[model samples]
Target chain A: MNRIVIGRYIPGNSFLYRMDPRTKLIAMILLMVSVFLIQSFIHMLVALLLVALLLVFGGISVKRVYLGLRPLVFLLIFTFLFQVLFNRQGDLLYSLELHYTVLNLSIAMALVIMWGFTKRFLRFRLLYFLATVAGVFLLFHYLPFGIVLGEGTFSVYEQGLSTAFFIMVRLVIIITLSTILTITTKPTDLNLGLESILRPLRILRINAEEIAMIIAISLRYIPTLLDEANKIMLAQASRGVDFQEGKLKDKVIQVVSLLVPMFIISFQRSDDLANAMETRSFVPGQKRTRLHILHWSGLDTTALAFTCAALIGVILLRVVGW
Target chain B: MNMIDIENLSFTYGGKVEALKNVSLCVKKGEWVTILGHNGSGKSTLAKLIVGLLKPQKGTIRVDGVELSERTVHDIRKKVGIVFQNPDNQFVGVTVRDDIAFGLENLRIPREEMIERIEHYAKRVDMYSYLNKEPQALSGGQKQRVAIAGILAMRTEVIIFDEATSMLDPDGRKRILSYMRKLRDDGVTVVTITHDMREAVQSDRIVVLKDGEILKADKSEDVLKDKETLEKSNLELLLPLEVLHGLEHKKSTNEEIKEFLWQLSLNG
Candidate 1:
């Protein structure tokens, strides 16, 4: 559950945290655009370094940034493999004959080996996945028990590696920068920033304020809904609904039981909330003043100016074909 | 002048279930009143009605001399604020300070004044240290205290606790009750909707509701002494109150009754 800290804000008074949310938001957008625009690995590395410096200045720990990236490990690995395997333009690093039957053993022995590997894979997924990938390549190189079905080769292209590395760095930096933004900015300020950024859409009759309110309420309710769902799950577990250990059918039933009650509770809660909001004079689409009026400080101005200058530099490099 | 005045209040749920029927009550300015009832006894409905959260089918509710209606609800709400039963559900903000500022924000209070009120009320509820803490991180009692602080920040003349302590433990309940006492002492009108006889005993007056109608409304001690009315409402006397009631024939003073209970506990 702690791993679901993507949208949760950690209160702080660091330079990045104290700068206006509008500045942070604009910087995030410019940095994200710059990350995608940088094609060369060196440029990507520079972008990553800039993000790293921002993280340092923001008082965010490397461990926290790494934890934020944990959920993306599989995506990173998948993209890396996709690039490595599919990009056939690369020069061959090694070649081998892939045999149809690598295991020259009795059925019982094969079943035992398969079972052992399956257990290990289930227990240590990431490590086992890497090990299995390595073992498959090793088997292709070394095994000579059966006839070869086809020629298999491992290749690493200069172009593919550079592209893959650039993509990976871009993704890591974007995610880290965005995480830092959310970690520093409070939800309410984020809502206000979004509203202000999108205020131009109001001329197109888009109701930006209402949209911002929706985002703000959704952000506020995420933790609350998670807590409620947790309580419902625990209650169902107490009633012998084994969510962790059960057949698919049993798990479905357990999920349904938890979800149904949660939906009902949420509906009731929304009703009460509507009444409460109404009593508190929260009229939809009506103009309301804020208690925390966002003011642009000199720090915000400097931060925005730096971000724009960096963005211009990235653009200049691209235009000049650096 | 009446802080809150209700005349023949009747409310139905979706025109089918009657939640309250022909109930009327009044609280004088700065008075402490407890509305006591069992579950499904219309106590919460009455509280909501007074706070203008629910419209009555037939009745007039006035808070600070302003009649409660759709047009006047916003103004009425300024005069009266309610702290609801579920602390988690009622909380609209992620953190304690944000929640306390919520009402003040709606009222359009200036940022500096909102901050001052937040600090003052948070300190009043002894939640100053946890002002930045998320509502989920707080205990049930702490959350309720934060809710109270939010309402207190509104600076409403009439404050309603609609089963606010029902979800809390004994210690939390005591802590909230003490706050209610403090509010009363500060000349704020307090109306606590509760089924807890112990809490009712501490109020200046008690209005007992049964089956959506007012069964009895009187001084707290008089209401506590009415065994028939208490039994009819399915309200039980607190243990000490029960003991005190048993010695009513002996005409014992409250201090003497307390002394006897202490001696009885010592003997045990």
Candidate 2:
């Protein structure tokens, strides 16, 4: 079998791909700080442009980053709605007054939520969701009665719109930088870099090696644990447990049954692993060495310098009160 | 000196059930020894005791003349390593090269030497092409081979297989058994703990265990011929007697195999 492209590492030999993982990790952190430092639209525009340049250099398409953000669609929409509805500052750019049927609106909202929750299990989802929303509004004229809320006025301010736009831009910049980091570096190398960064905790009597081992082992066992969970789920399914179609209560019970066995299996595995590690001559907290030595080259230096300059540039913008 | 010497060794689970009781055995240097028994027959317990995974309550275990104690057990483990039954549980690294490098790293072997030993042992196990592949992507047979290469690269004088092939398929079992043959040929003292009679019969000597005690210990042929003692020990002869003997005398191969194939196809 071919090698699994572990955790979003797209195989390519771009500038970011050739840079050291530690350099990339540090650069990602610095750039993320730089993103939040921008105080004005001009700086936000400049940040977005720099991030776009990074995307091109890393060979990642903007469409791929957009796909990665798909899972956060609901969260992003919620943030936009919350920002638009609540914030009242600066001049009122838009204002509206309307009387609404509180009862019918509540009923429509309840039905739309039901559709949202159940759509995951349904094959034909978009039609149900669209019908539930569109049907309620289309039938509004025919509805018999409604509990009318008095006329309510709401205003959208200039400052509110600007804040919403700023927050959205900042989020996109951070996520894009993260996407570049994840795509360019292997997960193992990422962990190795994290371990090297955490080595300073040794003076506090905290074992960095143990923490790193814990992380590496957890990462290693994720697939094994998933495999175990799958087998347990199958065993439960053979006994006629309906995991696919369930009410919230039934799903809770079903998940408990799976979790208990998964816990037992993992505990037993950990015990066995202690013996296995011992047999391999792994003494806890003992002096150890590494096979993979991190190398620093001119490429890494250049990459680190770029992130540092970006951070400093952001600081300079902040000082100039932009 | 014996490669491994155990005298009157005993281990109890939580101070109630005896896993191994008063069992004494000696493995000569470079010899392959198989501890064969049924499930719950304490064969695994004995292997763990020798490797210092568990402390023996009664007597002494000496590996190459270093007595196993709290102080010396770590050093003994440095000389003896084990490849366990579950290939998934035993794998410790993300990839084949990393897994092999793990044991060497723990032993504090330097980087360049570690790389050389990793390449050599991986090629020996026919997994050099899969050095970058994760353990989850490999089959049970391939993972077990990586486990063996890990122990072999540590340069341990003694290596134990604790029913290592039990979870593998027939093809996987055959591959592991062949590697056992290679390890024995390379003069690494090999101890194979198993319930399978086929795997047991390949060892230089067989020690049958029943109820946490040694039932019989002798050469492979001697133990096989003594069906009465084996039956008394309550181990089933899963291998049919005539076929086992037929396989042993490999020169009578032509007509016997043909007849067996005819019988097999007819039965099918």
Residue pairs in candidate 1 whose N, alpha carbon or C atoms collide under 3 angstroms: none
lDDT of each: 0.83, 0.84
Q: Report how far off residue A180 is in candidate 2 (Å).
A: 2.4
The count of backbone overlaps in candidate 2 is 0
Q: For all candidates listed, what's the TM-score of chain B alone?
A: 0.91, 0.89
- Colliding pairs, model 2: none
Tens-digit lDDT track of model 2 for A127-187: 5765775566544434426777554555788888888888888887777777777778776
lDDT value, candidate 1, whole model? 0.83
Judge candidate 2 at residue B156 and give its lDDT: 94
Which predicted model would earn the best lDDT?
A: 2
Q: Highest DockQ, which number? A: 2
DockQ of 1: 0.47
iRMS, all models? 1.6, 0.9
Q: Native contacts retained per candidate?
A: 0.48, 0.79
The candidate 2 chain A region of ten consecutive residues with least summed lDDT is A1-10
